[model samples]
Target chain A: MKLLTLNFLTCAIKTCKTNSASFPLHPRDAELEIVEADVNLPFLKNILPRLMWDELRGICTELGLPELPATPPTPADLIQPSSSTPETTDAAPIAEADEEPSQTAKDLHRVLLETCIQEGKLVCGACEHEYAVKEGVANFLLPGHLV
Target chain B: MPNPSTPAQTYETNHVHTVYEEIASHFSSTRYKPWPIVQTFLQTQPQGSIGADIGCGNGKYLRDKSQVWMVGCDRSTNLAKIASKNEPHSVIVADTLALPHPNGVFDFAICIAVIHHLSTAARRVEAVKCVLDLLRRPCSSSSSSTSIFTSSATPSGPGGGGGDDEGGKALIYVWALEQKDSRRGWDEGHEQDVMVPWVLKQKKEKQEKGRRKKGGDEEVGAEETKQEGDKTFLRYYHLYRKGELESDIEQAGGVVLESGYEKDNWWAIARLR
Candidate 1:
C-alpha cells in the first residue's frame, strides 16, 4: 500500500472508530520498495492543506526515513522560481503550466507516492489488532468475530 | 437453498463472495466498459479530491479520472488483487459494512452495482450508512441553511450544489426491478431476491484454437452451445424498486440530493444528514 493511503485508514474494528491512537496505523517490520511514478504537481498542491503533517512525519520516523520539516510546504513552495527573470518582479504572468516542480515537490512525491510497503504488519495502537500487508495490498478484512 | 435462519453474512459468503473469487478473472474481463452515469460522476469531481470506491469490482471506474485520487476496496481477495494494478490509486480487501476509512474525511465516493448483493433489507441500509459515513460532513452553517431549499428543488446534476461547502456526496447504484424490456425481462412484480447465474466456460483445445483464430467475440457467441464442461455459478441479488433507494438513504440518516433511473439501475447521490 502507498504511504499516502495510511493517512486516511484506521482500525476496521467498530469500537476503534472513536479511539485517537487508531488513526495513524504504525508500520512494523515493513519491507519498503520505491516504485517510481511521475510526480503530479497539482495533486501535491491541492492535497497540501489536507495532509496531517505531524502524523505523516511520525510514520516516516517510525520507518527510519529522513526527518521532514516541522511545518508542511505551501503551494508556492512546490513550484520552481521563474528562470527567465533571476530577480524578483513585482508583476508575474499567471501561467501555471509554465512553472516547474521544485525539489520539495519531488521529495514529497517520493515519500507519499513512490514509497510502498511491500510486506509488513500495520498495528493499530488502540486495540493492538495487526493488519497484514503482502505484495503491496493491505488486508483490512477482519474476522467474523472481530467484526 | 440456504436455511431461512442462516445469517446474512454466511448466506452472502456462499452465494456471493465465494462465487466472485472463483469467477474474478472472467468477471473482470466482461466488466471493462464503465456505465455512462458512473463515468459522468467520476469525471465531475474537482482535482485532488479524495474518494473511495466501495465494492469496486475490477476497478474500471478508477481509470476514469486522473486528477482525483480514489481508493478502492472489495471483499474478494482475487478481485482486490486485480484492482490494485490501477496506478496512483490503492485497493484493499475489506467488507462494505466494516470499511477501514476514517469517518467524514473523503471528498466523494461511488458504489456501483454493489449494494444489491446484500441479502436483507436491514443489511442493505446498513451498507449505505457505512458508505455515507466515509464522506466528509458538510459545514454546519451552510448545510443547515441550504439543505431545506436544495431538497425541495429539482434534482441537481452531479456535484451540483453539493460540492465542497455542502459536504462529500456518494453516488450509489443498484440493480433495478423494472426492466421488462431487458434480456432477463424482470418487471416490477418479479421476485426481488434471486440467484443470477454466471456461466464459466472451460477451455477445450478445439474451442481455444477456434477462439484464437476468430476473436474475443466468438467466445460470447459460443455461450449458447452450453458445453458439458461449462460450470455455472449462482450469485445473489436484491433488485431495488422505484423510490426504494431514496427511502433507504433516508433511513440511513442521509439526504438524497438527486436520484433517477439509468439503464435498468437506480442511482442516487446522497450526503449525511
Candidate 2:
C-alpha cells in the first residue's frame, strides 16, 4: 500500500505542470463582440437609462464626450438594441476623453458611443463556442461533437 | 426554471452576455460592490435557507453551496438568453412580475441593484408585490409563515451616489413606462433628478482621478462620456435608510431582523412577519 501510494504521488508530481497559462487545455480569448451600449435605438430618445446614466455619463466626462442629458426622451416603443448580429469587422468602440459625437442640446450620442463598448464573447477558451454578438446579444453555444 | 432535463443542458442554448461582461466588469471595476456583499450574505446563510437571486442576470452568484438551494431569475430575454448560454445549467426566463413557483418557496430572496432599474412606480410596485406574494406563506403552529428578502442599491439624486442601503438611500428610478406617446414634454424635475446621478458621477470621477494621480489603477477605462451622453440615463438612485427599509418590510409582511452596511451600501436580512 505504501509503495503504491508513493508511486501515485511520484507520478502525480511529474504530470502536474505548475504553469497552466501555457497548457493547450487553457482557455483562449474567443474575441467575441459584446455590445455594451444601445447605439441603435430610435433617434428621438436614445440617451442612457437611469441605471446606466451616471456611470456612463461620468465615464463620458472623463473621456471628453458631450455631457449626457439629465432627463432624456422616453422612447418606449423604440426598437431594443436587439439582434444576434456581431460587428464582424468593427473594432470594439472604446470611449475616449476627447471626442464629442453631437452638438445637439442634451444629446447623448457621443456619450453612448463612448461609455459603451462591445463586450468579448465568452468562449470555452478551449472549445470554440461561437457566441455571436448582434445588437448586444451573446450566444455561447457548443457544437454537437464538443458537448 | 424547468426540472433537470434528460442529458443535461449543454452550451448550445444562447450566447450574448455583454450584460454579464458589463455587469461583471462594473462590479469588478470598483464601481459596484454586490459581489462582496454576496460573499458575506452567503457566509451567513443558515445552511438550509432556501435562496433565490431575484434579477440574477445569469447564475453569476449561484455557487457551490450544498446547503442552500438557489434560483436565478432576470426580466430581460436578451439577458436570460445570454445567461442561459454561459451558465452550465439552464436559467429560467420570466418577468419579476411572474414567478412560476409556489409561495413561501424560498427562505430568502436577493434583489441586487434591481429596483432602480425599473422605469415606473407601477411596475416597481407590481414587481415588489409579486415577490412578497410569493414570500408570504402559512405556518404550521404559528399563524404566519416567514421568509426574508434582501436588496442592495445606491442613493438617488442629481449626482446619484452609490452605497449600501444601511447608510440609507433614496434611489429614484422610473418604475415603468406609462405611455407610448412621444409628444409629452419631458419633465424638468425628473431632469433635476437626473442631475443627481451626473453630479454624483462627477464626484466619483474626481475621486477616482485623484486616486489615479496618486498611483491608483490608471488602466481603468476613462472613455465612457461620449457613449454615455447619448444614452437616456437614470434620473437618480437613492438608497433608503435601514429603519425605513425595515418598515417597508413590515408593510410587506416581514420583520427586519438584521440590517447593516456591507461595503458602504445597505444590506439587510429581514424575515416575513
Of the candidates shown, which would achieve the greatest lDDT relative to the real structure?
1
Candidate 2 docking classification? incorrect
lDDT of each: 0.82, 0.35
> Runs in model 1 with CA error above 4 Å?
A86-92, B1-6, B140-164, B204-225
Alpha carbon lDDT of residue B218, candidate 2?
17
Give the clashing residue pairs of candidate 1, or none. none
lDDT at B229, model 1 = 82
Candidate 1 lDDT by residue in tens digits, B1-273:
112334888899899989999988877765666777787787777666788999998898788546679999998889999999998899998889889988877888999989999999999999999999988787634332122112212221112343336678899999999988766779999999988887777865565455455432312322345678889888899999999999999999999999999878899999998
DockQ of 1: 0.46
Task: For each candidate, report its DockQ versus the true two-chain complex.
Answer: 0.46, 0.01
lDDT tens digits by residue: candidate 2, A7-74: 00110111222322111121123222222332322222212221233433443444354565664434
Tell me the spans in candidate 2 whose CA falls farther than 4 Å from its real position: A1-147, B1-34, B85-90, B119-126, B136-138, B142-242
CAPRI-style class, candidate 1: acceptable
